[model samples]
Each structure stands twice: as C-alpha cells, then as structure tokens.
Target: MDNAPLVIDVAGINKRFGDKHVVKDLALQVREGEIFGFLGPNGSGKTTSIRMLCGLLTPDSGRGTCLGLDVLTESAAIKRQVGYMTQRFSLWDDLTIAENLDFVARMFGMKDRSTVVDKALDDLGLSGRRKQLAGTLSGGWKQRLSLAACLLHHPKLLLLDEPTAGVDPKARRDFWEEIHHLSAAGITVLVSTHYMDEAERCHRLAYIAYGTLMASGTAVEVVTGQHLHTWEITGTGLQGMGEALRALPGVDLVASFGATLHVSGKDRDALEATLKSRLRDTPLKMTAVPPSLEDAFIYLMQGSQDQFQG
Candidate 1:
C-alpha cells in the first residue's frame, strides 16, 4: 500500500470515441473514506470519467493512480479492488436474492463463497428477502441487492452511478445511511447523481457539463461561488408565472416548490433589479431569498456549451 490519503489522484485525463470527445482534460483527487460525488447533466461524460478513475475503461490520455496502482498499467489490479454499480439494474432477476449473491461470489472465486454470501446478505439486511425473486422486488430492494452484489468481492472503492434513481424518498434515505456507514469504515466512494439532496450528503462534490469540469468544492463553497440571487414568489398563476420568468433576462432558473416560485440568477444586482421591475407594477409579490445548491447548479449549467455533440 502507498499509505497515501488519496485513493484516486489523476491529472489531465481525456477520452474520445472516434469523432466525439467524451471527456476533456479532467483532473481530480478523491480522499480516502470520503463520499465524493461527480454530478452533471446527462451525456456530460461523468460516466466516462468515472470509468477511467477505477480502471474499468481506458482513457485516451491520462496519468494517474487508483489505490496506488497505475490506472493504465495496473487496470486489472484496480478492477479487483473496486465495487461498481451502474445506473440500471444488471443483476439476475430470475434468481433468488441469495442465489444472485452466491453467483457473484462464485464469479469472484472466493474461497468461502457461502460465508461471504451469508455475510453480505446479513450486512445489507437482505436476509428477509434472500429467497424472494429479484424480478419481483421493488426498486429499493433491488438497489440493496445490487449494493450487496458489488460488496461481495471486498472492494476498497465504491463507484456508484446514480444508485438512488427511481427509488422512493425513504429508500433513498436508507441507502444514504448505508453509504455513510461504509465511508466510516474507510471505503472511498465516487458517486454520480443529479439530486441536490443527495449531493448535499456527499463530503465533497464536483460538477461537470458538456465534457468539461465546472465547479468542485463543498456544498457551501460551490453555492457561494456561483454568486446567484433568488426571489421567492407566492401567489396564484404561479405556473404561468414560471413561464413568464423563463424568457426574462438575467433569470437562470425558475422552478416551483409546491405553492412558491424560486427564481434565481447569477447577477445579484440585475436579478433583483429585474424582478423588482417585473413585480413592481404587477400584483405579484416577491421576496429576496438566499441562493441554494440547485440555484447554483442551474447557473453553472446555463454557462455551459453543448460540446458533447449528443
């Protein structure tokens, strides 16, 4: 072991698929035992970059190490030490949960497959559903099973691509709880997600768009750096009001939360001045509010160009 605090330290990574440049000059350092997130819009190269980090896929150009192993030369070594879960369910749905776990253990060729499978099931709280057909399980249960399957090989790093997508709110919370527990146990995690709430749960976050890096920092730092202002508008016709604000200059994001409208823009003076002018003459009421993570993300993305060509 290198005794280094970082599990992934890479620089100037790039990837291309024929005419398409999927990732561009990306560099990142992920600390051991921290929940670091890679957040971006769809087709933003998050997946490609993550694959390069864990040695799952080769980068056309890059120099780095994962778990003190060369990302390019020691790819097979790194692959054995990482747990990867994809955006879609890839487990055997026709088999029981216990059978699925046992299969994964067998694939890894563990010396004690039964012990590992039993421990995995018990650790993930899947003992109750061990005999259930995976195809009949709900999204949450399926997520748990997927996680258990990944952990069967005793990986040091966990790479999750939107693991909580389509899961219910309560299940998402439970999933996060398990993630935190794993982090506490000295496992490094690199996750990709779009949910602001989930991003907040991460120790640090990196934002990417159009195959380029944007802002990366703690939640508060990133939010503050965006320099966005918000206005909370509450009244009837809020749905139409959102549409009206969309075309207005200086408005980066106009979203509704139940009965209220959140309008955000990077330009503080222009945003306040513009919304003041818009609401001054109309009957609509507006109140200046603090900018949030979602507001900052929207502002950052608004500045991105569609360079992905997808």
Candidate 2:
C-alpha cells in the first residue's frame, strides 16, 4: 500500500454556507486501487467533502490534486474521470434498468452505447432485470442498477456515498464483494458509510465529526491509537449496571451488547480499580478485552464538539 500513488490527495479544504462552517481544513489521501472508508455521524459533512473531491462542489479554500489534476482549476476534467454514486438513488425511477444505463451512457457520449450498456447489465447482474422499472424494483435491485450506471463511463475512480444505506444484509455483502473485485482491477474507491463492519473492510478508514477529521488509519491502528481500556462484564440483572458505571469516575463509555456490557475508559488503572471495587460483591464476571473499532468510533464522536451547537 505504501508503494501506490495517491488517487485523491487534498489538504486544508474548507467550505461554508452563510454563517455555518460545513467542512473545516479537511485533508485526506486515498491510495491507488484502495478502498478508503469515510465515516462520521449524520450532518458531519461527509457528503459535502465528497462533492468537493469529485468536482460536483468546489472547496471554499485549500489546494490539491485529484487524479493528478488541479482540484481548483480542472474540476470538469476530474468529474469526467470519476464516477460518483450519491447517497440517495438519483436514477430515473420511471425508466427500465436498461434504459437508465443507456441514458447514462448517452450523457457520457460513448460511441458504442449499446455495447457498453449490455456489458454493464451483465457485469452487475442486472441483465435479468433489464426491463424492470427502476422504481418498481426492491432496494437491493435499485442499488445494483445505480452501481451499473456509475461504471458505464469506465471511470478510474469511484466515489460512493453510503451506497448501502437501506440495502439488505445480503445485498450489502454482495455490493462489497463487487467493490473488492473492482479494487483488484485497479479502480480506486472512496466510500462513506456508517457501518463499522463495512469500515473494517476497507484498507484504511477516516472518521470525521462536525466537519473535522478526528482519525485515519488501518482498523487496528485506529483502535489502538485511542489508548482506551475496555472490559466486558456479564451476569444476570445487568440492566442498571450501565447507568451505575457511567456515573463512576474514569468510565468513559458503558454500552450494552446483547448479554454483556462493554465498559471502557481512557484511564486504565482508575477504570479497573473502580470496576473491581464496585463489583467485588456482585456475581458479574469482568474480563479485560481489546478495544474494538466501534468502541473507538463512539469515543471519537463523544469527544467531538458539534459545530452547530454554538
């Protein structure tokens, strides 16, 4: 991964609307053929940042290159080489799957529109439903059709904005499989998602909150970088344990996971001491466990100050 050239490299990018600062000095570098995951809470500017990178919206300030073209000057050229799938399904719902693909091909001005459309249908497993109305299809099928349209231009870079928001688990898995396949074929992908499992699938990940970048690295690195200590507590009647733990000093997070409670804190010794002292008379079992990506994700979100709150 270190040997690959950067497909998307930008720094100090900022954007604003009226008095609201949307994205503030955001910087990122996505490697060639890499699946870089972009994660954040809702209203965190993930979508806006994506637009700036893909030439759909220009950054208010900052300078960098995308696909080695000047982001500030050659946005049109960048847009041509990049395929973007929006968070919402933006395709024509009244049109059939095949017709949608044909329309996208026409927009790209491909001379061999028929051949390109046919190949796209087959590639994304949409051929069987080529005549199906996009609006009439289910969420998974619509997702497949959106992906097919994105690839019709044969773009070198793919910017997917939560492509699986409402998709089923099976369809999400299939979409990710296709993503990995595309990466192997040397198509760089920059995707935004809220799912931790999907974030772990990427070669690297970046977490943003309130339009600010808080962390970026491999899954392990991001988890370890937080230096958080976590303990799993299991026992009967664990209902009120979370509230009790949250009130204690040194306990930063207390989340319930099915049959167990994951308690985490930044101060290791203090957290351990508090847990032992509080639970010594109880029947609960406390076990030291490694901090997970989700733990780190929540931790980051908790620490971030919402820009709109003021």
Candidate 3:
C-alpha cells in the first residue's frame, strides 16, 4: 500500500445543515488502485462525508486535498478528475444506452465522444444493449449504464454511493467484479455500502455513526479491536433467549441468526462465568466463537450517542 499514490487525503472536515451537524471533523486517506469501503447506519453522515471528499459539497470548516488538488478552492479541477456515481440512477431514462453514453461524453466536452462511448459500452457489457431504453432496463442494467456514464471521462477516482443497493445478488457480484477490474487498472474507488459482505470485500473499512467515525481498519482489525468475546448456542428453545441473554450481567449483545444465537460481551471472564452458570444443565450447545463484523458494529452502535436524536 505504501508504494501506491494517495488519491484522497483530507482531515478536520465538518459540515452542518441548519442546527444538525452531519459530519464531524472527518479525516480519511484513500490510496490509488484501492477499493475503500465507507459504512454506517442511515443518516450517519456517510453521504455528506463522501460529497465533501469528492469536492461536490464544501465543508463548513476544514481544509484538504483530493487527487492532489485543494478540495476547497480547486473543486472544479478535482471534479474533472473524479467520476461520481450517485446512489440514484441519475441518467436520462428517455435515452437509449448508447445515446446516454454519447450525451455524457458531450456533457464532458470530449472531442472523441463516439470512441469513448463505444469503449465504455464494450467495457461495461452494454454493447449488445446499445439501443435499449434506459427506463426499460432492469435494475442491474441501469446500474451498469450509470457506471458506464461515469467512466465516459475516464476519471482516475470513482466515488460510488451505494451502487448496488437495489441490485440482485448476482448483479451485485458482477458489478463488484467490474469494480475490481477497474481498480486493477489503477483507478481508486471509494464506495459507501450497508451490506456487511460488500464491506468485507473492500481492502479496508471505515465505520461511522451519528456524524462521528467509530472505527477504521481492516475487517479483522475492526472486529478484534472491539475486544469482544462471543459464544454461539444452538438449541430448540431459543425463541426468547436473545432478550434473556441481554438481561444477564456479562452479555453486551445478543443476536439471533436463524437457529443459532450469538451472545457477546467485552468482559471475557464475566461472560464465560455467566454462560457456564446459566447453561450448566441446559440442553443448549454452546461454543466460543470469534466476534463477527456485524457484532462489532452493533457493539459500536450501542455505545454511540446519536447526534441527531437530541
């Protein structure tokens, strides 16, 4: 990672709308040719932070650089070098696939509009559906077209906001494959997502909540950083077990995954003692397990004070 260039470097960025502080002194760095995932609950300032980083929105107070340009004063230059794919399908629905690409190229004032459009179509597998209407396309096709349009200018950095939110599992997998392909070609990607599986796919992750960053590291690092002890139990009478476990002295979290119940806490000895004493003669099968990404996020959320609720 040290050998790669820095695509985005920003610090001390803050934004507020009315009296609500959306992003709070956020700092981040994205290396070239890396897929960095940004994650948080809804209204946690993920979108606001992404916009500020990519130069789409200015922060209330901060200074930084994006793609080597000043994020504040050089936003126009930074905008020209970055390809932003918004959460919504922001393309023209009335236009055909090829026409949409042509329009995007024209908007960017590209001299080789046809050549760029053709290349984008082939790269995103839209060549065969060149005449298909954007509005009539499926969610997956629309997503591909949006990506294609973003690449029309051949930007070095990509800011994708929940690019696969409504896409099917198969389509999401295909989209990620294309993203990896782009990354291999030296394009830096910053994507925000809610799916844990998608978050795990990134090289590194930053989790935020209530306008503040909670954790930042690899998946394993984040999970281990929580210093949580988890035990999974599979049994027949586990309907109300989650609530009961939450009320116990040592348990900090209790989540049910189908037939298994995951009980976790920060205190190893107390948790173990409580489990051993409570389930000594029960028919449940309990075994110690490593804390998962979801477990760590939930733990973090539980401790976080919601900045908007008050």
Candidate 4:
C-alpha cells in the first residue's frame, strides 16, 4: 500500500464563492485501488472539495494531477475518466431502471449499449426489476440503480457523495460490499460520508471541517493521533453527570452513549482526578476506555474554527 501510485494528488488548493472562502488551502493524496473516505459536518466543504478533485469544480489556486491529467488544464479529460455520484438522486425518475442505465450508456457513447446495460443490470441485481419505474423503487433500489449507472463506463476513479444516505442498514451493507469488490478490482474510490461506521470501512480517511483538513489516516492512526484520554461512566444520573463533566477543568468532550457517558479530556491526570473526586461517594461505575472513532471525529470537529461563525 505504501508503494501504490497516487491516483489523486493535489496541493495548495483553494476555492471561494464571493467573500466566503469555501475551501482553504487543501492538500490530499489518494492511492490507486484505495478507498479514501472524506468526512465532515454539513457545509464543511466536503462536496466542494470532492468536485475540485474530480474536475467538476476548478480550484481557485492549486497545482496537481488527478488521473495523471492536470486538474486545471485537463478538467474535460478528467471528467471523462471519473464516475461521480451526487448526494441526491439525479436520475430521471420517470424512466425505468433499464432505461436509465441504457440512457447513461448512450450519453457516454458506449459501444454495444444493450450488452452494457444488460451486464450492469445483472451485476447490480437490477435485472429482475429492469422494467420497473425508477420513481417506484425504494431508496435502496434507487441507490443500486444509481451505482449501476455510475459503473456503466468503467471509470477509473469513483467519487461518491453520501451514496448510502437514507437507505436501510441492509442496503447500506450491500452497497459497501459492492464498493469493496470494486476496490479489489483496482478501482479507486473517494467517498464522502457522515456515518462513522462508513468512515471506518475506508482503507484510509481524511476529516475536513469548514474547508480545513483536520486529520487523514487509517482509523486507528486517527484515533491515536488525537491524544485524548477517555472514561466511560455508567450510573443512574448519567445525564446530570455528563453536564457536570463538561464543566470540569480538563474535560474536553462529554457525550452520552445509551446508558453510559463517554467523558474525555486531553489531560488524563486532570480528567481522572476530577472524575475520581466527583464520583467518590457516588454509585457510578467509571472505567478508563479507549476513545472511539466518533469520539475523535467530534473532537476534531469541535477543535476546528467554523468559517461561518463569527
């Protein structure tokens, strides 16, 4: 993996919409055949950054190559080789599943369109519902159809923006299975998602908050990089305990997880001392625990300065 050639390499990229600098100086490297997860809060420039990487939106200032083509000078060629699935369902709902795939193949000027569409349908398990109207399909089916369409032209790199949003757990699982299969076939994927479980599935991931890249690494590396010490407390007054934990001197994160509260801080000694003192006479059970990926995510997000906020 260390020796894999980078399929998406860009640096010093910036984009602005009027006075709002949407994406700050951004730098990223995604290896070929790697599933690179892009994660961030809403309005954090995930979409904008994805567009810039895939050639849909030019960076205001940057120099790099995506698919060996210059991002600034060869965006048209870059668009041809990349498959981009938008956040929303962008296909024509009036068309049938088969019709949608066939139309996309046509738009790409693919040879033997019928054969291509047939294989796509069979590959995605859409052959049985080829004639079903896209609008009548459930969210899962629609998502499958969207993925089939994206794979029609056999793009080298796939840019998926929250492809599993609003789908059932089973559907999301199935979709990830397909993604892994594609990665195994040497198709690089750059996917943006809000789900922590989904982020963990990626081979590597980067967290961006408000146009700034906060962290990029494997899940374990990211979790370790935060240097946060965490404790899990279970008690009857977890809600009240969480509030009090947030007010302590060293506590930086206090989040509720079901019946337990995950309280974390950068200063382990201070956090432990404060908690031990606060729960000295209480019945609450406290145990030192490793911080979760979501803990690191929230920590990174909280530490970032949102450009929109005054």
Q: Give the range of the ten consecutive residues with the poorest summed lDDT in model 3.
A: 301-310
Task: Extract clashing residue pairs from model 1.
Answer: none
Off by over 4 Å in 1: 1-4, 306-310
TM-scores for all candidates? 0.91, 0.97, 0.96, 0.97
TM-score of 1: 0.91
Instruction: Write out the backbone clash pairs for model 2.
Output: none
Against the true structure, what is every candidate's RMSD?
2.8, 1.4, 1.6, 1.3
- Tens-digit lDDT string for candidate 1 (241-288): 888888888887887788988998877788888788887766678988
Winner of 1 and 3 under TM-score? 3
Would you list the C-alpha lDDT of every candidate in the order shown? 0.87, 0.93, 0.89, 0.91
Instruction: Report the Cα lDDT for residue 68, model 3.
Output: 93
Query: Largest lDDT belongs to which candidate?
Result: 2
Error of 4 at 94 (Å): 1.7
Candidate 2 accuracy as lDDT: 0.93
lDDT tens string, model 4, 239-261? 67788778888899998889989
> Which should have the higher TM-score, number 1 or number 4?
4
